[model samples]
Target: MKWNSSHKAAGQHVHQPGDKHAHAAGDGHNHTHGGIFGKNTELIFSLICGGLIGIGFGLSFIDGIPPLVSMIFYITAYFFGGYFTAKEAAQTIARGGFEIDFLMFVAAIGAAILGSWVEGALLLFLFSLGHALEHFAMEKARKSIAALTELAPKTALRKDGNGTNEVPIEALRKGDVIVVRPNTKIAADGVVVKGSSSVNQAPITGESIPVDKEPAPEGSFKIEETGKLDDKYRVFAGTINGNDLLEIQVSKEASDSTLSRLVQLVNEAQTQKSPTQQFTDRFERFFVPAVLILVVLLCFAFLVVDETFSTSFYRAMSVLVAASPCALAISTPSAVLSGVARAARAGVLIKGGRPLEDLGSLTAIAFDKTGTLTEGKPKLTKIMPLKTDVTEVQLLKIVVAVETLSDHPIAKAIVRDGKEKLGGEDLPAAHDMEAVLGKGIKAALGNDAIFAGNLALFESLDESKPSAEIVAVVRKAEQEGHTTMLIRRNQEYIGMIAVMDTPRAEAKGALEALQREGIRKMIMLTGDNQAVAEAIAAQTGITEARGGLLPEQKVEAVTQLAQQEGKVAMVGDGVNDAPAMARSTVGIAMGAAGSDVALETADIALMGDKLSLLPFAIGLSRHAKKIIQQNLIVSLGMVAILIPLTILGIATIGPAVVAHEGSTLIVVFNALRLLAYQGK
Candidate 1:
C-alpha cells in the first residue's frame, strides 16, 4: 500500500495559527479556576457564605441572633451558589424552551423558597459540576475530528527553480514542485519524480508496514507479484515521506486533497440526523408540551379538591422540571461522536454517521473479484509454443517486444515477465505499434509483422493462420484457471502467454468471518470469465459467483441483491467498482490496494486491505446499535414510570428530581459504552 501521510501532515496547518496563544489562554484560565468557580477566591467566598447560612438556620432554632440577620446570611449563600444558574434558567426560558440546566435551576430555587436552603445550594454546586463533566466528556469524544485539523504542518518546503523555500501550506498551488525530506510530512498531493524510500502510511491506509516507493512509473514498480499500480498514478495528501528526499510535483492544492474532502464529508455526516435522532426529536417536541399540560391539570385538580395552592403549585413545578427529556436529546450525538472517533483510531474512515448507521443493518455483501478479492496485478503463469521448432525464448522475445509498446495491464505483465528472460537490454524494437481498445495490439518488429491479443486480435488479421498446438495451449491454460494471450509473427502462430490474478491469502478467512457474522448471502461479481471467477470464488469459500460483468453490470448485481436482502454492502477496489460501491447500501473500499476513485467513492474505507475488518466493522456497528436501542428504552421507560408517579402523588418533588437526574446519567453512561466496543 502507498501510504499518503501528506494529508495528515497538511491537516496540522488548520491549527497552526494562534495555537500557542490559544493554549496559553487555556492554561491561564485553568490556573485561575478551582473546581467550578472561576478562582480560588470564589471557592473561599462560597464556603464562607455556606457557613454563614448554616449559622443563620441554627439561630432560627435558638433565640439570640436576629431573624433579619439570619435571613441576610441565607440570601448570601443562595447568591453564592445558585445565582448564575437562576440567571441562565431565565435566559433559557426567554429563548422559548428549556433544558436540564433550567430544570435544575427551578428545582434549586423552589428548595430555597421552601426553607431547604442547604439542599438548594448543594444541588446548584453538584448540577453545575455535572454539566462541566458532561462538557468535558463531549469534548473528549470530538478529539479525533479536532485532531484531524490539528496535524497539518504550518509550513511547507516549496521547490523554487534550483533551491527550496519554506512557505505556508496555504500558499501552495497545483503544479508547484515541493521537496519532502526524511521524517517530514508531505504537504500536498503529488508524484515522487525523484528519490526512493519506505514511507509509513498508517495514518492513511491503516497498514503498519512502511511502503517502499521509487521514482518509476506506477505499473513498472512492482513491489510484489500481486501488488502494482497502473500508469498515470497520483499519490494523496497527509502521507509521510520517508528517509529519501522527494521532489514531488503537486497535483492538487492542500484544501482540495483527499484528507480535506474526508474531513468535510465527515462534518456533513455528523450534521445529518439518523432515524433514531429524528424519532427522539419528534417525541421531545410533543413530550414537553404534554408534560406542561399535565402540570396544568395537576394545579386544576388541587384547586378543585380544596388543597393548598402553594403545595400544589410547588409539586406541579417539580414535575415539569423533571420531565424535560434533555438527556434523551443528548444520547444519540454522544454515541455517534464516540463511535466515529473510535473508528478513526482503528484506521477505518467512515465518511459519516449515516454510513455507520447503515453498516449496522447490513445483511448481505457483494464483492467485485478482480481488485477486491483477487489481487488485481496479473502475472505470467504459463508459456506455450505453437509452431514446430519454435523456441520459448524466440516467442517470448517477440511477445515482449510487441507488448512493451502497449500500456495495458496484461501487456505490462507479459513484457515484464519476458524482459527477465531476454537478459540484456538489446531486445528487438517494435515500430508502428498500435493498441486496439478491449482487443490487442499491432506492431512491426524487425521485418516481422506481430499481432498479440485475444481471439479478436487474430480475427482482425486478414492472413493469420491458426495452429493445432496453439488451440491446445489455449484450452489447457483456460482449463487450469489462466487467461491466455496469443502471439502471431508474419501471419503465423508463434506462442501464447497465460496470465492469472492470484487470490489474497486472507480471502478465505475473511469470507468465513463474514458468514459467521450472519451474512446470509455472499456473492462474487467480476468482469472475468465464468470459469476464472468461479474457480477463484470456490477457493475463497464464496458459494455464488457471477462473471463477465462490466462496470454497469456490477452495479446491477448490487441493486438486485438489495432487492433480495435487507441491505447490501459492496466491497471493491477498482475505478470500475466505484459505481457499484456508490450504488450499494454500504460502499466499503479496499483502500490499501484500491484506486483513488474507489477510495473517494466508498462510504466506509478499510484502510488496510485486510478483508477481516469488514466482519469486524459490521459486528461493531450491530453492537453499537443494540446499545443505543437499550439506552433509548431505559431512558423512555424511566420517563414513563416517573411522569405517572409524579402525577398520582406517589413521588414527591425531591424524589422526582433525583429520578430524572439519575436516568439522564444512566443513559449518558450507557451511550459512552460504545467507545469501549470491540467485536469478535
Candidate 2:
C-alpha cells in the first residue's frame, strides 16, 4: 500500500498571484483534489471509479456472468476510488492524527471484510466524489480574486518627444506619458494631461458607471510661468477608456499600481485564517483521534453485550463514518473565501478573516475629521463686498494677487478659487509683499497699497484698517465657524472671503447608513478648533465630536473608545490615521487609491473614496459571520443526529455514507452562498 505524499504537499501549499491554476488549496481540510487547466482531476477520477462500480454491480446481476469477474471489478473499483482516500488517511495517521478521510477509509475496509463489497465500494465512491465536488465549488471563490490580476493591460503605448512605441508595462516609469487609445485598458495609474474621455473603473474601484476623465479639476492646474502644468482627473490602471483618446501620464510603476496592490492584498487575505477556522483546526486535531478511540471502545462494548463479533464490528464502522468532522473542518474557510472575494469585487479590501470577524462586532467607529468626514481641503464658500466701491470680482483680484507671494494653505485655496473665476485674466502684480508673521499680507499692488489679512492684522494697523461695520461682519463670519479673511485696500475694507472645510457630500449619508447598521457611536476627532469640529459633526450626523486633538491625543481617544464602547474602528486616510488606527480594534483607510501608506497601514482599505463601501463592508462582515455560524450548526448537527442513528442499526454503510457526504455538501454550498450576498 503506497501512501501518497503529493496530496499532503498540495494541502499545505499556497498559490501565489499569477499562478496558472487556482489551486484548491485553502479549505480547513488538510487535503486537496485540485485538477489542471481549472478542471477537477478528482472529479474525473471519481467518474472512472463510479464506472467501475456500475460495471461490477451490473456484471453480478447478468445471468451466467462469473462471480469472480464481478469480484475483480469490485476490487479494481476499490483501488481506483480509495487510492487518494487511503493515501490521505495514511498521511494523517503517520502524523499521529486523523480526519474525515481516515474515518471513511476504515469504514469501507470494515464493510469489505464483512463480505459487503458493494456497500464498501459505494461508501468510497460517494466520499471521493463529494471531495471532488468541493474542489469545483471552492474554485469559483478563488477565481474571483485571481481574475483581478488579469484585468490590467500588460503593455502600454508609450509616447514621448521622440515617437510612440509599445513597451512592456515593466518598462514604463513615473512621469512617462502613455497614449491610451479609444476603447482600451489603461496600463498605469496616472492623471490625464491631454484629451478627454470616459473610462470604466469597475474593475479596480467597483464603480458601476463610467467616470468622465479630463485634465485635473478646472482650477487645480498648477500654471507656472515656464508653462509647466499639473496632471488632472485621476485615472487608475486596469480601467477601460471610452471611445475618445487620452494621453495619461503614468504616476506609478507597474508593481505599485492600485490594481496590483489590490490583487496582492487579496491573495494574502485568503491565507490568513479566521478565528473560527483556527478553532476548527484545533478541534479536528483532537476530535479525529477521539472519534477513532470511541469506535474502538464501541466494538469492545458491543462484544461485551453478547453481540456477534462481526456484527459489532460492522456497526462500529457505521458509527465511525457518521462521526467524522468532514463538514466541520470546511465550515469557515469556504464561507470566508467567498466573503473575501465578494468584498474585493465590491471595492472593499478586507485584509483577512480576522478583521472580517472583528468588524462585525464593532460598537464604535472613530473618524479622523479633516479628510475622513470632510472634503479634505478648504473651499471659498462666501465673498462679501464690505466696501461699495470695489466690485466682487475686483476684490477677489486684489486678494489673489496679494496672496500669491504668501505660502499658506488659505493662500492656496484663494489662488485656486481665483483661477477658476479669473480665467487667465492677468491682474496687477504685488511688490514689497510683507507677510505679518501670523496676521496676513501687506503689499503694493501697482502703487495702490493692499492689505489682505484677518481681523487681527487690521486691528493691529492704526491707519490701514477697516471700519467698525466691516469688523462686525468679519466677527459674525467667525462666529459661524468659518475662516474669514478681511480684505483691505489703503485703510478701506474691500470685501471678505470665507473659507470652510465643509463635510463631504457623501458623509451624512454614509454615517446614517452606519448608524442603521447598529453602529452605536460615531465620533469625530480632529486637530481643528472645537467650533469647526462641531460644525462638521452637525452636518454629518456624527454622534460625538472631539477637536484640538494632537496625534497622540487621537490615539488616546481611540484607546478610550475601545475601552468604553468595546471594539472601535478608526477611519481615516492612512497617512495621519496610523497611530489612532493602530490603537483601535480595526483600522479602515479611505480613498486608498494613489495612497501607498493607506494600502500598507490600514487593516481594511476602502479602495476608492467611496464611504458607502464602509457600510457595505460591515454588512458583509456580519453576513459572513452569520454564514459561518449556520455552517457550523449544520455540520455539528449532522454529527449529533447521524451517530446515534448509526449506532442503533438504523443506517448501514451505504446510507451512512450518503448521510455524511450529504452534510458535507450541504455545508459547502451554504458557505458558497456568501458570493451572492449584496451588501447594503
Candidate 3:
C-alpha cells in the first residue's frame, strides 16, 4: 500500500533482484503482518513494563505481594524491547564512533537504567517505526537510477546467415547483425542494409513523429525527394522501428551501443559529488567528533557540580542522542532523488545530482548553431547558376547523382531538390566517391571530374576566372541568410546550392526565459561561415557568434567562455560537439537521436531537441537547490536547539528523543518538495 500506484503497476511485470516487489506478492500478508509485529514490539513491551510498575505501586497499597517481583517484570519488558536497538547502536559506535542509530540506542538504554522502563520502550518503538518510513522513502527516490538499468533487454535476437539465434545482450559482439521486428526496440547501433520503415525515435530523440527510414544502399541512404520517401534510410538503437520489417547490419556491439554508453555516462554522473555534498562531508569530519566531546563535557560538568550520577549520565546521553545529525545525513540524497524524478517527468534526463547542482550557477551558455539553436534539418532555400551556359536543372542533376550515394543531411537536401527539378533519370556511375569532413566531396563521373562543397573545398582550384559570378551568388545567398555550397565541373564553377538551417520555433522563447534567469551572455559556435552563423544567431536573440570553427575550435570557444565567466554550459548535438561538451561546466545534448557521443559526453540530455527545455532545466535545478538548503538549515537547526535544551535540563530524555526523530521527518518532507518543481 505504501508503493505509488504507477510503481506498483511497473513492478507487476518486471522482476529484478533486490526489487521490493520480488518478495511482496509472495509473502503478501506475511510481510505486512511482519511490519505490524515490528511496529507493535515496542508498544507491547511498554505496556507490559507499565503494567508491572503499576502493580508494584498497587502491591505497596495492598500489603500482600512483594514489590521486587513487579520490579523484575518491569526490567524484563524494558530490556526485551530496547536491548537490540541499544546493541546495534553500540556496534555502530564501535565501528565508526557515533551516528543517530548509536545515539538512539544509548538514550533508550539510559532511560531503562534510570527506571523509566515505559518511556524507554516507547522510544524504541517510535524510532523503529520512523526508520522504516525513512527506508521506504529512500527506496522510492532510487527508482530513477534503477529504471536506467532496467531498460537493457535481457536477451537479443541475433540473426545469422542460416537462421536466428537467441543470445544474451551481454554476449553480443561487434559486427553482429540483428533483426528488429515492428514496434520492437532496436538492440544495437547499426547501418540498415535492407528495409524501409517509419521509425518512432521519441525514446531517444524526444521527437514524437516517426521518421521515415530506408536501407543505406551504397554508403548511406539519400533522401531523393523533399518531404517524400523514395525507399532508402537507416535506423539506430533507442528507436522504435515502425510497420516495416528491415534488415540492419550491426555496426557496434550491444555494450558499445548508444543506450549502453548513456547508461555509463549516467552512472558516472551519479558518482560525481556536488559542491554542497563536498562541503557537508568536510563539516561532518569535525562536527561528529566535536558533538561527542560536548556530550562528555556535559557529563563531567554535572558530576563535578554535585549533580547525582544517574541524572548527569541520563542528561548527557539525551544530549548526545538529540545532536547526532541523522537529518543532515539524509538531506542531500533526499533532495537529489526528488530533483531527478522531477526532471525525468519533464522530459529532461539529467544523469546525476552534480549537474543539477551546477546548472543554477551557469553564467554563459555556448550553443551549437546547427541542431542546438537551429532546426537540424536543412531545407533547399535557393539555387543559382554560376556559368551562363549552365542551367539550374543541369547543375542539380549532376549534384543529386553524386549526393544520392551519401547519407549526410546536406547531401539529402541536395538530392531532394535535384529529384524535384531534374526528374528521375538513369544516373551516371560515380567512381571513387569520397566526402571531405567539414568540407565538400570529390568524385569521378566517367571521364569528367566533379567538386562540390563550401568555398574552402575549392581553395586549390583557380578562382579568379569564376570569382565575380561565384562571389555575386554567394553574397546574394548569404544576405538572404542561406548557406551556399558551390558546384564545380573540372575547375569551372557551374552553379551553387543554397541550404537553410532554420531557427527552431521555440528558440526565441527558450532564450528569453534563460535571460530572465540572469543568463544574459548567449553565444553560438558553429562550423558554418560568419554570415550564416550570425544570421541564425540574430534570429535566436544571440548577440555573440563565432563561426567557421572546427571540432577543436569549438572546445576552445567553450573553454574561453568558462575563463571569462564564473560557469559556462555548452548545448550541442553532433559527434563534432563532443569535445566542447566535455570541456564545459555543464554540457547539454540536444536531440540525442543516434549520436552516442552527444549522449555520453553531455551532462544533461534533452530527449527532444526542444530549446524551451533548457531554461526549464536550469530553473528546476535552482528550485531543487533551494529545497536542499531549506532541508539542511531546518535539520541542523533542530539538532542545535535540541542538544542545548537537553544539556540545560529544559527537556527530558523522552522529549529530546521525540524532537530529534521529528526533525528527521520534517527534513525529509521538506526535501520531497523538489518533486513539485515547475519552471516559470
Candidate 4:
C-alpha cells in the first residue's frame, strides 16, 4: 500500500475564505475562541433573536403596543441574527471578494430599506439556521478523524536491561522491546517476540470479534506471506490486547504507526474538495455579482413600466433573495462529508469525495481469488496411495515432516491437517529439506530420501514416473479443482495429496448485491489453475474468471476491463495484486486489518474480511450523489421560478425569503439523511 502522505503534509492549505460561514450554520462542535460562549451558546442566542422578530411581527398585528416599539423589536431581531453575517460580508468586501454571505447581506438590507423589516429579519434568521445545520453536518465528517486519534494509546511499557519502564509512546524508538499487558491497547506497530493473546481489532479493522494471535513457530516455512506481518506474530497500535502478557519488538515510530496514518489520511481527505464543489465555487465566483446586476436592471425595467419606485425596488429585493445559491454551494460537500462519515462507521475507509463519487459510478468490479472470494487458507481434501506397503497415515506423517520447513499455503495445510489427524504424535524429523520454488519439497527422513511436490518436480527427476492409476487420480483431482502434490520415496511414486480452498460464505450474496446496485460486470482474477479458479467462480456466481495470471498479467487484465467495462474496482489482499489494483479505476483492499500498505494503497479499503461492506459502500455513494443532484436542481430551479414571479408582482419579499432559505434547509436535511443509511 502506497500512502499519499502529501495530502497530510503540514502547511498544506486547509484555509477556505468562506470558513466564517461555519458559525452561522449553528455548528457548535468545537469552538476556536477561548471565550465563555461557544457555538451552542451562539446558536441559542440567535434562536432567541429569531423569537424577538416573531414577537415584533405579532405586535404589528395587535391593537395594544405602539408601532414604534414594534419597529424596535424588528430592528433588534435584525441586528442579532444578521450581526455575524454582516460582519463576514464586510470582511469579504475588504478582501475584494464576494460570496454567498455578501449576497444574503445585500438582499436583507435592501428589504429593510424598502420597509419590509420583518421580512429582512426572517431572511437573516433562516439563512443562519441553514448555515448552522450545514456546519453541524460537516462536523460529523470531521469526527471520523477525531475518532482515529482517540484510538491510539498514549503510553507504552518499554523493556530494558534494567527493567520494564513506562514511557510516553512518542519517546519510543524502533527496535525497542515493549511489554504489553493484557487488556491494554498496543502503543506502537511491532512484532511479538514473546507471549500470545486475542486482540480486539475493531478500532482499526472494524472486526467485531477479537482475533487470536500466537507466535509462529521458529523455522516453520509459510506460503504466500503477502510481504506483510502476520497477525499471529504481529501487534499494532490501538488494538485491545486480550488476557495475556506480550513482549513486543517495536518496528515503527509512534508517529508513523498505522493509527496515526489513518488519522492523517482522513484529515486530508476531508480538506480536499470534490469536482462538484470546485464547479459550484467557480459558478458562485461570477453568479453572486451577476445576480446583483440583474436585480438592478429588473428594478429599472419595472420603474419604466409605470411602477412606483419603492415597489420596483421591493421587487428587486425579492429577486435578490431568491437568487442566492446558498443551497447549491453546500450541496456536494455536505453529502460527501456525510457519506464519508457513514463509510467510516461501517469499517470502510474512503480516501476522499473523489473516490466516493467514482465508487458510485463504477460499472464493473474485479476480484482477486485468494483471500477475497475464497477463504485464503487451503485445506486437505483427499489422499490417494498408489503402491504401498505404506499406510495412508504413515505416508501423511512423512509428507508433513518433509513439508515442515516450506512456507507455502499447501505446506501449511498439510502440517495443519497432520496435527489434527495424527493427534500430537511426533513424527520423524526430516533433515536437509530443500525447497524447489513453485514445485515442491525434498528431504531426508531416516534412510529414505523423500520427494513431495507437483508433476513438474517428478518430471525433473531421473526416470521417476507414477503408475497409470496414480496418473488417473492426479487428473481427477486436477479436474475437480484441487491442487495435487505427488509424493515419492526413494525414486518411487508413493502417493498424492489434494488440497483446495473454498469460497467464502458471503461471496454469493455480495456478488448479487453488487449486480442489484447496477454493477454491469464482475470478474475474478487469480494465479491458480483454470479449474480451481473456475470452480470458485461457479460457486460464487461470478460471471467471468481468469486463471494462471502472473502479477503483471493481472495488471493487464484490470486495465483492459477498465477500458471495456468502464470504471473498475479491483479487490484483493495480496502484494501481487497491488499493481493491478493501482491500474483500476478504484483499488479496494479487503481485510486490511493491520496492513499499512493495503490501507495506504487502495482507494477504498474494507477493514474487515467480510465482503458485506462492499455493497453498502457503493450504495451509500450512489445515494449521496443522488442527493447532491436533487439539491442542485432545487437551488437552480427556485432561482428560475421565483425570479419571474417576483418581477411580475406575483410574489413578495417575505415569501421569496422563506422559499429561498427554505431550499438551503431542505438540501441540508436531505444530505443529513445519509447518516441513517444502514446499507441495503
* Strongest candidate by TM-score: 2
Against the correct fold, how does model 4 do in TM-score?
A: 0.59
CA error at residue 83 for candidate 3, angstroms: 17
Per-residue lDDT of model 2, residues 404-454, tens digit only: 887565777888988788888888788898876446788999868888777
lDDT of 1 by residue, 1-680 (tens): 00110001111121211110011111101112234544343444445555766777787887776777777767777776555455545665676764444555655665666555555655555444433322333222233345454445667889887889999888988768788888787777666667765564434432212445556564443222211342123344666766567777676677876556545532321212245644653574566556667777776776677688876876676666456454554455456556666776677766544466667887788888865787766778777777777888878877888888875556777788778767885777898998664457889988888888777667666755566666776777786668778888786777788888778888999899988888888998876668888878878988798976755577668778887885778888765565565556567888788766566556677887777778877777787677678778877887788777877778877787678668767876877787787778
RMSD of 3: 13.0
CA RMSD per model (angstroms): 13.0, 12.5, 13.0, 10.2
Which is superior by TM-score, 1 or 2? 2
User: 1-680 in candidate 3: lDDT tens per residue?
Assistant: 01111112112222211111122221111112123346444335435545555555455566667757655655665564445445545555555644454554555566666665544554555444333333333233223334444444667678877898988777777557677787787776666666666665534432322456766556443322211223225444666776667776666666766556544433322212356655664675567667767878877776578888667877877776677566665666567667778888888877655577778787789988777787766677677777899887777777887787765556777778667766666667777788764467888877878888877677654553458657777777877678678888886788888878788899988899999998969999886667778888888899698876755577668767776786778887765565465556677887554255565556678876677898888998888888778888987899889977988899987787678768778877887887887778
lDDT of 4 by residue, 309-363 (tens): 6677777877887776656656665676677788889988776555677678888
lDDT of each: 0.63, 0.70, 0.64, 0.70
What is the TM-score of candidate 2? 0.61
Tell me which residue pairs clash in candidate 2: 216-232, 216-233
TM-score of each: 0.57, 0.61, 0.57, 0.59
For residue 145, model 3's alpha carbon misses the true position, in angstroms, by 19
lDDT of 2 at 643: 88
Show model 3 residue runs off by greater than 4 Å. 1-272, 300-302, 375-378, 385-410, 417-467, 475-495, 500-502, 527-532, 548-556, 574-579
